[model samples]
Target: MYQQILAPLFGSLGWSAVAAALPLLVLFALLGLVRMTAWKASLIALAVALAIAMFVYPMPVDQALLSATLGAAFGFFPILWIVINAIWIYQMTVTTGHFDVLQRSFSRISGDRRIQAMIIAFCFGALLEALAGFGTPVAITTVMLLALGISPMTSAVVALVANTAPVAYGALASPLVTLASVTELPLADLGAMTGRQTPLLALFVPMVLVGIIDGVRGVRETLPATLTCGITFAVAQFAASNYVSVPLTDIIAALLAAGATVLLMRVWTPRGAEPPTSEPAGSRAEVLRAYAPYLIIIAVFVVAQLGPIADLLDAVTLKFNWPGLDIRDAGGEALSLTEFKFNWLSGAGSLLLIAGLLTIPVIGISARAALGRYAATYRQLAWAIVTVMTVLAIAYVMNTSGQTATLGTWMAATGGLFAFLSPILGWLGVAVTGSDTSSNSLFGALQVTAAEQAGIDPMLAAAANGSGGVLGKMISPQNLAIAAGAVGMAGREGDLFRRVLPFSLGFLLLMCALIALQATPVLSWMTVM
Candidate 1:
């Protein structure tokens, strides 16, 4: 097996690290500076990564090609799988004329755009993140915002921003699980530290969403509702993640936040709220039918999560070592050899596909019509498919060739200031890989090692990796692809990325401050022992 060499070119770690980052820099420059489309940028970036892997890192050609193929396969099976079906279900509602009723129902709850954003994008979106993450929340909620008459670009941006807070606990605290596994830290302590850190973001994200939706005036007018939602969610998240079950943390938090928002709406209305646009309030049964798709999704996901069902589903999962990709890291540790387990039955994508199919009868559409809609969804998401696959391939190539490790090793040289930079490692990982779980897996041990060397609490640094990684989700290419597809801006992934970059960076800075404080005596008491 070929082993990675971090400082491959000049034997100088700094220069080698800079060379390793060229592919990402190319990606960002093309997307942000040249304003190229996401698909083109991602494809070019993938080519750059392959060249660097071969010439600089000098990875074997067969192994590099296999890595790219595996990444592309994963992107299609699980990532695009979820995006396509989620949008398919929404399209079913539109085709059946039920989306109009759904829109009217939300309007009746709160006519103000600010309140609506808080309720749907922040609150309901968090619920989706808790249950069916991996682009589900962004895909579903962006479309919901569009149905509310929000502009496409604004809807995409708002959904991306609102997705941040719950992501640490998302998919049943998967990111935390990955962190614990990587750092060999106590799971509970890591959860508690993460709980303490991310709730700060939770308390402020609703305000950010409202500001994005309607600016400072929007935040000012809807201050009470925003505060209630944020505070309630933050408190529940902290309590559940620390004191209660980490796996159930986001579920409890999302439900409580949604309940609080609805309860507050009964008594208060934002000042200067415009009159809601009038639409036919369909009968109660029709409204319920309008919601049937999501209900089916929830029920399906819950049942799939049951122990017996999950075990049975696992029986059919395809697992194997990826062919021609066995390799080792610079430290002579063997990299993960297991290929992507094709979790066909239990995956969120399969569940979403099932949800879409079941919605056909509920929405009174024939199987042929549903199939046609599904096909149309594929057509709509063509560019998104390309973009996501290319981005994932780039991530895989960089990871396997040790390009990511080269960068991480360079960052670890920060010494005492590494406390402040810990979260940035996680942020960069997630920004490249598009999953907080992946981020924690990539950087969690690095955080621990860096902390030990820097004379800080290893657990605190590792937990910070997870807490801060959530902020990167909004700006991740996979997520931006999902948002762009959901909002019918399939080729404009860069636009969504540019819009959410500020929020992502701002949240990263806040996380750095919080972590820096925890490392010092100022907030050291907050770190879980």
Candidate 2:
């Protein structure tokens, strides 16, 4: 192994680091070029990663496998837990007919396809991203846009793009919580810096989403609404993350945007000819019944996740760290690794259960139908869960194995242009797996380290890692599968990726520009001007 993988390379490096990294580069190359399915790619990557750890990096094999297993399990349950429940809640709305009201409500706000896409997928979805993120916004907003007669491709694109601005604060700001715990940056400081950094991205998101949907004309027409949503979202993200705990930022931000947009849409009509009229409204009682469960879920989720009563429930949490995966600080000191344990009482999963209960009575969902739908949504999410687990396992291995360090060392050699290259690393992460959570988990720490080494502010760089990563979501193999599954576009995943690549590249450029601004003294303009 050393002869073929290490000797000549080591000669140049004067060490075995070269041998240690060959496996990693090969794994990434094969995945990038072969267009292999995620499962296969993850397996291959894991295998090479294992080999590197044991032979080159000298990590114990059992320990390596155990770490990978624990990481995989974490990816499968709670992460997948969020995705499945989010889809189920939306499915519950659809199966019970409340979706029609949702569609009409969106249309009444702005019937133009572009504006509607911006509102539902961009602004509204960002709110959801802030609230329940993971895959929730995409599942809900895409379905709603489709219900409103937007093309399936358009809906998926809009949802994926809108997913960007709110991700750091998503699912009640879990990302920031994770970032804080890992970095030991004051949660408030990280939250505040992320808030300051992300709203900067938020400012441009609506303009990007609208331009994508209907071009300059559409952007111009919906400028008022777009600007309002972006500013509101940015300002809220800045304040919520700065003042409040990270865990509640997304929840509060999303709810505020939803409430504000809902209230505003009542009186704020937009310019241009609206689309075709939607069907008449459903009975108020029917709408109320249809939505009761979701209301309960949100209510319970909010109270349990935060609020005065949360401590009582939170007292019953499941907490522990994965043993044997001690990471390092900037120096050689080992960083404490605590993967927050699942708390059944206060965990997001429990809130989902609460939502379902409140929803069942309100929607008049028969117990039989509710059980059937819940089961079906689980089945739908199972493979996705597997995919996330598999990919995350590989990612965790690479991260803990110091493989990312090996890679980061090589990349950081490009001193001045590191800002430009930074986004690609984030992009490749999300491109491999659909969810930004997965991407951020895979690279968030790496970005921080890279930023510090490159003499850049870690928060600006970390936020760019997130914002740039969002562009890849549209083309992620998992996302393609979901959208295709939703619209019967299966077996044509390649076609969809091919179609979306240009837009993906374009938006990535926009994000890259935003990230570069942070490093450049001139970027004060992007923030101030």
State in Å the error of residue 341, model 2. 2.1
Question: What is the lDDT, from 0 to 100, of the residue 138 in candidate 1?
Answer: 92
* lDDT tens digits, residue span 1-529, model 1: 6689988978988998988899899998887778788999999999999999998989999888888998888788788888888899998889889988888888877778777767889888888888788899999999999887789999999999999889988877888887888889988888888889999998899999889888998889888988999999999999998899987888899889989988888888889986554665688899999889988998998888899988998899988778767888888887763367788888888999888888888989888888888889999888999999989999989999889999998999899999999889989998898899888888889888888999999988898888888988888888888899877897787777788898899999999999999999999988745
Clashes per candidate, residues 3 or more apart or on different chains: 0, 6
Can you give the TM-score per candidate against the true fold?
Answer: 0.97, 0.80
lDDT of 1: 0.87
Question: Where does the lowest 10-residue lDDT sum fall in candidate 1?
Answer: 273-282
Name the best candidate (by lDDT). Answer: 1
Considering summed lDDT, which 10 consecutive residues are worst modelled in model 2?
Answer: 1-10
C-alpha lDDT (0 to 100) for residue 30 of candidate 2: 49
Residue 204's lDDT within candidate 2 is 78
In model 1, which regions exceed 4 Å deviation? 274-280
